[model samples]
Target: MSTDVEINLLDNRWDASVASGMSESELLLYRSNVLGSDKRVTNYGGGNTSAKVLEIDPLTGEATEVLWVKGSGGDIGSIKMDGFATLYMDKLQALKSLYRGVEFEDEMVGYLPHCTFKLNPRAASIDTPLHAYVPRKHVDHVHADAIIAIAASKNSKDLTQEIFGDKIGWLPWKKPGYELGLWLDKFCRENPDADGVVLESHGLFTWADDAKACYDMTINVINQATEWLAQKSEGVAVFGGAKHESLDVDARRAVAASLMPAIRGFVGGNQHMVGHFNDSDAVLEFVNSQNMEPLAALGTSCPDHFLRTKIRPLVVDFDPAKGNLDEVMEGLPAQIATYRDDYAAYYERCKHDNSPALRDPNAVVYLVPGVGMITFAKDKATARIGGEFYVNAINVMRGASAVSEYVGLPEQEAFDIEYWLLEEAKLQRMPKPKSLAGRVALVTGGAGGIGTATAIKYLSEGACVMLVDINADGLATTVEALAAQFGGDVVRSVEMNVTDEGAVAAAMAETSVEFGGLDILVSNAGIASSAPVEETSLALWSKNLDILSTGYFLVSREAFKLMRVQDMGGAIVFVASKNGLAASPNASAYCTAKASEIHLARCLALEGAEGGIRVNVVNPDAVLRGSKIWEGEWLDQRAGTYGTDKEGLEEMYRQRSMLKRSVLPEDIAEAAFFLASDLSAKSTGNIINVDAGNKEAFTR
Candidate 1:
């Protein structure tokens, strides 16, 4: 549930012309659209809205007063004078100094009796403290369909981070009452200047000194989210249907006009496209779905849905020869069948042998060929949101056709995204980085120094990171350190040898559930071997491949499955040693495995691109993590073979770099962060340098 609104929330605004001594220009009527939009963004009883209403404080006997927020059940478009709530400005500010996030829902509501409470319009917005938390006169909180849909996606966190940066804090979904108020209280205290708040698995909050700023920010957030969503969507050329779609200006306007009547007629007047699904592929594929209801689940992803078409849209897939209504009337049953069949197939493909699958799709929409597909929801706004969503789903489905091996989310994983309380909780705790929130990220050998650093970075960026390693104590230590900071839910640690397939799969599955789905995976776990060619036994060769190469594949396979189903792009990075790109004598086993990783990243990068999954490799040269690189048997062995002192051997490594400074684990962590951030949004299938300049000396 969200309290934000779409553009038309002002359509039925109450007239204030009768009031005397007040300027009509400054009255809320001037900002009618904004007030109305505040109510259009959320679900049934989902969000709250408010406005500043001038009143005299009877106690102080002052000439002027404070903000009057919307009461419970007050629709923005139809709000009356009594619907606005009165809040003493000085008192509200006083509450801010408490430095706590506890909600005063009842406490605040209870205070109404003290000041013009009876004359006060409606009950105050449930989020009065939150609204008061904002230093703005106008405040809105709504579950916007576009933003929430993005929030609901696996990449929403990652994408949101990229789009919004630190400007907004992500509150993982928590129930929207007192507890969430505490969460917001904490967040506001931390980020005093944020213009908004993004509720993970929920909606968005936008406020301003004036109603217009509040309104525009709402539109801006949705529009930005819509464009970002478009880019992130799995889009492709149309297939198995009409190939030519060249309707010029007149035709385009005509189509929009034609659809308006039907859409408006069914829902009510004032219907509009808050954000339209206009891509050719999206429009084409969705219009051609065998069953529109199943296709409709993709329509609207979050709370703003109720504003669009209520909760979900009804499908009209069959021929509408007797006008569109005849077909819509008849296609309902078939649409349900198609939706059921698709869900069943998805369940069968992703089901583990143990669990029984649920029957209903999280949401649904549909239609027969030729006739336009309808997005069904309980409201107009959600229906419109659904229109774009189902189209994106179709585009991904078709693009996956090229790979012929594309798979959807597993039943349990899908269930997790649609209903994970923990995920919702994450929105409350972490700043939702549209880029990485709700994503399951794995860092191999996470117990090892470098792996631990990578795991921590991802967790900080709002990802569910599973740190894996063979050393039980090391894993415990890493987990303890990370959990203390990111919380136990955001960071998980597992002790398992990467070489075992069953062990790897179980670990991946367990980690995936804890985090929701896999998105960013870093394969940094590997054992090093320095035996010469002649001394390298067949046993050693097999062992190296087992722990290094085979291990990489096992982790990669499961990660690929999780990413593919979510339909959100994923990133996989292999921490191959510099030896893979160059040469190292007496290091046959280690070099082979390292080399294999480079090749694997390349091949997978090429193959997975169609699915929007990016693959890259990090070549780190002699990075120290309290390891023997600085002073120990490892460096001693190399120095002895080179007939040089420890200083001489260390210089040998540094000379290979341009900077001549030893690479530290922190340096590698920074590089990993770049590859995983928007800083390199367009990069993939590439190798990044974590080395000084080793490539210049050794060109292997």
Candidate 2:
């Protein structure tokens, strides 16, 4: 194995000019970013980095050595200087004396805060002491997959010693605490030539006097381990079986569509939940391996991953040939019951007096043979995180299996970290989630102004959104933008002409499968038509009716069917227009179609009331600016009707409303959000005017 250090990134965009005169803290931030940018080094929030620096006390004017370590809940990839917690080394070292005879679960947590040099609100990482005790100027710690692949193997100590010789020290599995720090301090003192330490079933720790040296050391150590595994596993197929074959996407989706809802209901407790499907090649290979059941029974690759993916994932049998969705659904309750029973039993065996309340017995990742993986959480972002961590776990497990056998931390040790008070406190300190945290929403006409705005609003308020539009290109752009703001898993795109009954049905089925089930539907897709009744052709009239009126009915019918199947009450909001309630010249087709849409909402409201579904309408007027409906010939014709230009028509409408504010796509979106959320639980068959203040279109 070559130990040469090279920084040949595919995209080496880091500016040396910008980094030349950086402060010690800024250099630390840059180094951490470099480490975090590599997924092979660490997953999200899975590692910590620190630098020992001299800081003059503001009050005393005395220089003291301090450790600035990555704080709790901070992502190293984009972290700023404030993301680190400053801790006094003297105080931290003194803590060892105080915690000498103290139990790790009881006494170590309270002393962590006292070691803080500055009274910052951010809590220091639980591994802060480990960083402080290292006798080096710079320290870098990561749950690198290559290192863990070796550390988590059945013959970890032997494999590690053979790979790195005495260049690295080894510690048996120990939860991160004062004892682990003391052990590391002792190991480094004894093995003065060791450049790093590998924690069995945990992670890697590398240190040097300078930041680059430490980082290079990490890369070198990981590369050696990876090279050894590569040589050992040459021509050895990791996954092989007759059962492993190409998966049927449609059949898997059908199975997911049928089984996810039941799983959602069982795991959701009182709150609703959403599920995301992951069929990446890595996930599929792991799920399809003949040894999948045995491999999955092994715990998570590391203890840090326990909070995202539970100790072990739940595995369910699935066969596309049998197409026995009902059988799978029938067996889910018992399977989940057994999972819960096993979890509770594990807790009973491992619980300490200081252990926090047992978390809800829910599986984070689900593995199905011949199908893909499904991850469930209270919201989309968390579900994506769980899915991502499981993918990483599979890679690590595969590497370890290729060498020898994959073995994770023992149950008791994992429990110690999962129920650790320090980790639990981080979650407790987070702000309360948004009202629509676990809800799912579908917005049609999503490529247009109103649809895109409504999707953004729902996402901001913490709802997973499905953007449906007939324009494939436009829909892809919109979904990409929203996914950037919210996470990609929280926002998705579906292409369908809402007027086609078959397309609408398939879209609804896909949405249900994608997000477990639906809760809110925004029927906002429509186009504008401007002509006098004498000038309007049959084709134009029929086209407007098919999309504006009939399309709303088709989408609502399909959405309502899924809502009823889930037995979960949902909301539907129809985007009509001010012309629907009032008369408008030269817009006979558009006005007529919108009016029909309004009455159709009312009829559905009456029928949906029995099923606890709320249906309402929002009438917006003259929202010309981002709207494609008022562009091109339609803009000129509407302006000509008022004997002025388009700008003049906009000003006249803005001045006509009581509020004198221009109605926008976001304005209609706000009204739609209110109707879709629980704020309007008792509201149905209602028309909210989003036209600034159009008294002429007001409803009694």
Candidate 3:
């Protein structure tokens, strides 16, 4: 272990000038944000920070000691002043008299609201007492990876002594509750000289009478552990050396694309689960390692890590060296079934009389032998976050197993935490999922007005959307706008031409890898050409057909491949035009292509019925506003064919309509949404005209 090791120490971000005029509570908020900004300091929404400050009581009209700590379910990295739960110190201290020992410590949670100061709505976290009883003005509890590595080590206590000597004390495993709070208080009192204590199998807690000192100590302590680990673990084989070499980047993604849809099919039986893929260096190192299976089986030690990542990861039976992805795909069903059975067995062995019933037996984290890691959850964000937690677990294993033996929380302990009633209550409080929750959709021509509108509609209802378009610039803008509104995890864009056979197939694979599998396909990619039969060039006819008829067929063929792979019923909604049914004087090519689109839908619906893949069409008429097809020559040509100017064409169509109304892209989007959603589950091979009222285009 004499190799040169470089350590990137956590920066002490606190500035004297920045801290000069802030109130004590403000300083705590500042410290929490800075600490949480680094994942090495703490995982997202993990850990707690607090400061006991004197505030004037609104009710009592007296300066009173109030405990302000990070609220439940809030991330400190982005917490605001209002994110802290404020409780009266005297009321919190009084709860000790109400405590009925460790067995009944959970009941103490019921009394927390009674201690609320000024009727603050933000609920205090379970770790409230851990900070409240610390007897310090400021306290921070963080799940810094370096510290947790030491805490999760088999010789955690000895390692703590070796690293920091008596400056930091050690506490054996105790699930956070009223009792652990008391244990923390007693330890601080007994060891007055200690700056912090490392909670075994959990995290680190550091406190000081001043906010800056507390923040400094937390960073300093973690940095010390990091430096020490780098020194001790240098030149040591990481994760028992890589058992398999990582596949090339393209090959890794190809494996993921092949596997994700299949895995998603099995796991999404309970509910549709979106997927996330991680091929980061850290993930690749662990997944390719000899110790990956053993370490993963031991599960994650930290509560936050396990809470999101589950008790353990499912190890995919893939051999990267042989590149036996086909064999692995064949074995996935049994592998998944085994994981579910194992999870059920774990539940049966560990359940208490009042334990919450077994949760989704599906694995959250999937470790491939060399490709990388895959995670599936009810949504993209959760799936992505789950992968992040597993990465943290990998980091912990790298350090702990290198120094000593890495130990996960005991099975019984992990089960208790997993099935904790408090955690169950929190889950029950979550809002009901939206209409399209957990479903993934791909919109062709997605950068266009109709495509963008449909995407927004689906996203508003909780669907993850993959926007596909030939327009790279438009796709990027649309992706950015949608990501800002719905979050980056749920929105993705692919620059693809629907008529290109290879591009279409690649886009389908990309969709599967991006969001598990496709549940909905909005075939809106099209072109319009207005010309009399004699004047219409063969090139124009072919161009219209290639983009409209041939493009839809290409996209649908790929969609069917993925849908069939998933074996999950899917919806394909074709955004054809009203001209499909109604013949105009000069727009033969445009009308014929649209008519072909409708016919194709009818054909697909017949073919897909047995497989539960519903195909439908939405025919929009005179949708001049925000319609990309009407932007250039088509608009002028349509206006000339209708004996009107460009601006007058919409009015003519509106006046001619039975209901006399203009059509817009959003109107088409609404019709498209209905056909794609479960709302139209029983209806297929159907056409909905979003033309205000076009009797000629009406379905018979």
State which candidate has the highest lDDT: 3
> Which of 1 and 2 is the better model by lDDT?
2
Better of 1 and 3 by TM-score: 3
In candidate 2, what are the lDDT values of residues 188-224, reduced to their tens digit? 8998889998999889999998876787888788777
- TM-score of predicted model 1? 0.44
Q: Each candidate: RMSD to true structure?
A: 22.1, 3.7, 1.3
Candidate 3 Cα misplacement greater than 4 A, ranges: 1-5
In the range 603-632, model 1's lDDT, one tens digit per residue, is: 899988998888888888877544422345
Q: Model 3, range 1-700, lDDT digits (tens) per residue?
A: 1234568799878788987899998998999999999999999999989999999999879999999999999999999999999999999999989888999999999999999999999999899999889988999999999999999999999999999999999999999988999999999999999999999999999999998899999999999999999999888888888789998988888999999999999999989999999999989988888788889999999999999999999999999889888899899999999999999999999999999999999999999987999999999999998999999999998889989999999999999999999999999999999999999999999989999999999999999999999999988998999999988888998999988999998998898888989999999987788889999999999999999999999999989989898998999999998889999889888889889999999999999999999999998888877677889998998888878998788889899999998888899999988998889999999999898887788688
Q: Distance (Å) between predicted and true CA of 408, model 3?
A: 0.9
lDDT of 1 at 136: 58
Q: Candidate 1, after superposition: displacement of residue 178 in Å?
A: 18
Candidate 2 worst ten-residue window by lDDT: 1-10
Give all TM-scores, in the order shown: 0.44, 0.91, 0.99
Which is superior by TM-score, 2 or 3? 3
Q: Supply candidate 2's per-residue lDDT for 274.
A: 91
Per-candidate Cα lDDT values, in order, are: 0.58, 0.84, 0.92
